[model samples]
Target chain A: MPEPVLELDRLVVRYGSFTALHGLSARFAGGALGLLGPNGAGKSSLLRCILGLVRPAAGTVRVAGRDARRARSEVRRRIGYMPERDSFVPGMSGVRALAHLAEVCGFRPDDAMLRAHDVLHFVGLGEERYREVAGYSVGMRQRWKLAAALVHDPDILFLDEPTNGLDPRGRARMLTVIDRVRREHGLHLILASHLLPDVERLCDEVWVLDRGRLKMADSLERLTAAARGAKRVRTRPEAAAALAAAARAAGLVVADGAAEAELVLTRPEAEVAPAEVFALAASCGAPVLGVRPAARSLEDAFLEALEGD
Target chain B: MAFRATEYERFTGRRARRPVWWPVCTATLRRGWSSRWVRLLSFGALAVAFGFTALFYFAYQVMPNWPTLLRVLGEDEGMASGFPVQFYAGLLHVFVYPILLPLSLLFGHDLVARDLTSNALETYFSRPVSPAAYVLGRTLAYTGFLLLTTLGPMLWIWAFDAATGPQGRFGEIAFVPLALIQGLVPVALVLALFIQAVSSVTRSGVWTNLAVIVLFFFGFVAGQILYEESDRPEVVSVPAASGGRNEAEPAAAAATTPAQAPVPAEETADNGPEPTVPADAPPRIRPDRLPLALLVGAALALVGGDPTPLLLAAPTLLFSGDRQDGRPPAAASAAVGRRGPPAGAGRSADRRPAPASPEERIVVHHDPRLLAVSITEVIRGWCLGCLDRSYPEEVRRAQAGRRHRFRATEPRQVPVDLARNVLLGLGGLSLLLLFARLRRQGTVG
Candidate 1:
């Protein structure tokens, strides 16, 4: 209804003659939009476009109701950007870097210092804020980067691969921060991630990219539901054969004795009643110890989409 | 619209504060002082100057028989040595300044160029600071740096000389303060001019700097062409140098001795049977009514080095030195014009009839006062310098006659070389352009 937070219209990015992003169109509103893609799929290109750090050849980008190509400074002021690669100003203290970002965003030194401290603390950088980023670990550096991007208190955030190089626990912490920033700050977010778990937990919608094209863009629910009939049911190691046949008869795919074989489901996307699966397991001769919805997997969706294409 | 405008004006008033100039200047000064290369350059400039000064100091100390240092600087010395003030002035004009001209490149060279190269110009251009501000900020920082590097050495020399020892009554013989101030003025002028000259090429600081260096390496000739265009083409055109036009103006004066006037060592009381220079009340020199006028004239002459700059300065020196104690103006001017066999004119064997002699010279041929003034006029006005313009056919024929040893008219001539002036003029023009480019890039994005 109202103007979307971001609208990338047929954006084409070319490096010389080779187009990196070939006229891709997409729009996002005030919610977390997850961008899931393989390497070289122009996902980072999309975020750069939103930040107005890179110009598109063919189409326009409307960011926060302004044409990004024209009112770049205005648009950039409203959007916080976290680059895919490390953009740390090495040799500067983490707090200092945050302060610089705030200053660049028009904060005075006193206010910038105070805001820097707040953002550092928000990203769990508390006392380590005084430490030089040169001495920081990958996880700490990653958090510091988040603090810089957030210090400006922008309305919309563009993060390209926020969890790309983090440990599982680090990735989990980042995801929690992202969700909190969105919910508490009422900020719109774009997260580019390869790990589907991050998207499932943090995104309100998803954009699946493969080979520089938007192969799938829909609500997270519908995106997963499209692959519903092929969901696998996990069973105990002993009764894997009978479990598979019965699941096949129900138009479901069940892999035998795989990891997490203690749970069973008709489809990964189905809203299964856990207690029902728990009770029906014994009669099928594959007693289920527990049951839950199968995690949505971008890898599987990506492979299947590539095959379909 | 009225209500919104009123509110906007109030908001603007609240936020329109900017930093004061001194703090900005101090910040700029600090930036340059702290730059590693800048530290090296400033000290290097001083070390070079000190070396030149020491050579003079040592020559005075070791060879008491050697002529005073001023003669060498004044172009009167048969042998070439150095003068500290003159050497200090020259190092800047000749070496340090030409190099400093292009430093504006460090700031602006990255302009329209590096933005496209790094894909970051978008980020820079989007900042509230405009392209103009960026360029101005960069130039401020760089020129401030140059001042620190150049003047820092001079200040040290002045302080050290002032603090330390000097044996005799020339009040420690330390021209350091004058030399120091003079040292900086020319450098600042030259660098300012060069910055303006080279600024139009690119938005890049490095390229502007590089262009300056490259121009210097090949001898910047474009400005020479410009100079040729601006100057009276028929006048004697010495090669233009890039720096220190302010301090080195007196180096070529032919008549009146400069502030550092060379008194021959042989003429010293030690060797030539003392002609008493009274130690007690310091030569009872008469006060001229126009000392300030003379100083200003000296300064102008030093800047342009035209006879006007010198003649205006020389009157008092002549008035003070003309009489034994007191005399009438006409007789004094004539008495000083007398024949003492022209200083450094040559052996008796080289003598021929003096050509183009002053009417004032025949009666007062023995007086030194008239001699100095007459000679100065001849050097400034009648010394034809070039073939196309700097010298006239008369000078050429005279030069040709010097070879023959016998010629028609037997014309007495005063010779000043034209080729050297052309070389200096061209050199100066090129250096100015180089600095102009540097300044432009440093100033505006």
Candidate 2:
């Protein structure tokens, strides 16, 4: 019911003869939305368009209901952007750079400095905040960029490849910071990344894009739930046949198994409760060990969406 | 002791609205001022200022009792008295041209280039700052440095002059500060915007600096060439009745005549006198075919009466040669004495008149087309000359002396004109606009 943080209406973007985005229209609600796309899938281009760095060839882009073209400065003031690339002044110290950017964003010098320090600490770069950005390691630079983005404390954060170019541990740390920003600060996040697990871990909704077109846009729960057509039930080999028969009689499609059996439910887990499964098992006189949804991972879903187009 | 928790705190304090360009301007200034080369250049500028100040102070103190100082030094009294303005203008020319212009390259070379190369424009443009603000901030930063080098020393000298000079001279030199600002600010602003514009086109600081240096040197060299070519003389033989020259004499006699001829190139190989153009030699441009309008325009502009021709010749106008004192170069004067029949010497034989005294037999040669060009040059020289208010009168007297010999001397008062100031100011503004447009296009980023 809250206004969408970002809305694009029939937005078309072209670079020379190559069209990067073709009539792309979508509304990103105020929450963590994953902008999932492969390389060259117009993800970065869309983000740039939202930030007003690249003008749309057709249609309109609005941030918080303000036209980005007409009220660019006002729109930018309420949004924080961490570009996918390394985008810091090379020779400047992280804190100084953040403070300077904050000042440019319309903060007083003292307030900018104080906010820079606070954000640096918040992003877990408190000790290394004084070091020159050029000398920072990849992980450190990522954290520093996050700090800079948060320094102004905008309404929404546009993070492009937030976990890009990081080791496993570094990636985990970055994701944790992103998650914290969403949960603790309660700021809307539009995270553009190719790593589906990263998106699934932090995002409430996912927007899958491929070849400059939106293939799917839905909540993570609904997307994964729809992909999951069946649930695998583990039971004693002797009771498997009886369970299968019982599941079939209950309007559930059951698959034959050598050692176990699979149950294709008539409805989603959200629609049908787990109590029904246990009751069916008791009626069939079968001992149930465990039951799990047999659905494709988010990565599989993303790839399937791309291939579907 | 009670256990305390450490965590990130949100800054909820009162936020004030700061100027969008403040951060960019301050950061650029801090970086430029902290550069070792910039610091060294600043010291050098201050050193030059101190040297001038010391000279002025010493002259002020000693000129009252030293009655023979002007005579012995062979310097004019006006120059001795009006040294502050002269020194200020001279220092400005030196600083703005040779020093500050190149130093601006160093100061602004990386301003926009670094942002583009490092992808920092994404971060900057994503903020609330607009492209115009970015350009304004960079220009201001470079202009601040330029002012420090060019105007900063002028102010120092003015203050020192007022404080240390004799009582009455301070009021006489009061206009020095205004003149310095008028002459130097436009040049500084132009250089700053020009360099920033260059910086915005490339991602390499070295390349930007090189481009700026090349542009400056090219403009200067091209201006000098055009000015010299515009001043080339036109030779016209005066009638024997007017200047008393023999018509029967061979035209080559003008070059061979011992007393009137120039010192031969071989004789003047060392430190004798500069070799003169032979009087009989054809003029660089034929007088009959001269572009009269261009010549007249150049002359009027030079005299500050009309600026149209000077505007047309703007490339060469600013580099007009230095002001000439009354004393003519020995070679020019020597060349003046050699005279023969005019161009088409054979046709004038029948119209020859009887010869007169040697001094009266002088030939007159002037470039009618170059009159404006020469006047503009002379005016520029006089405007920059150290003779104060008497400079124009001195130039007039020199023109009168030349006119007595039937040589062309169009005496005209040449003040610095408003047209020139407007042209230069427009040049700076155009560059600023260009830089802003480039910024809006996101060229540098």
Candidate 1 regions off by >4 Å?
A: A225-304, B1-88, B91-140, B151-445
Q: Proportion of native contacts found in each model?
A: 0.02, 0.63
Docking class of 1: incorrect
Clashes of each: 52, 4
Residue range A99-168, candidate 2, lDDT tens digits: 9988888788877877777788777787887898888999898988888788887888999998888999
Question: Highest DockQ: which candidate?
Answer: 2
- Tell me the whole-model lDDT of each prediction, alpha carbons only: 0.48, 0.63
Q: What is the TM-score of each candidate against the true structure?
A: 0.49, 0.69
Model 2 backbone overlap count: 4
Q: How close is candidate 1 to the true structure, as a TM-score?
A: 0.49
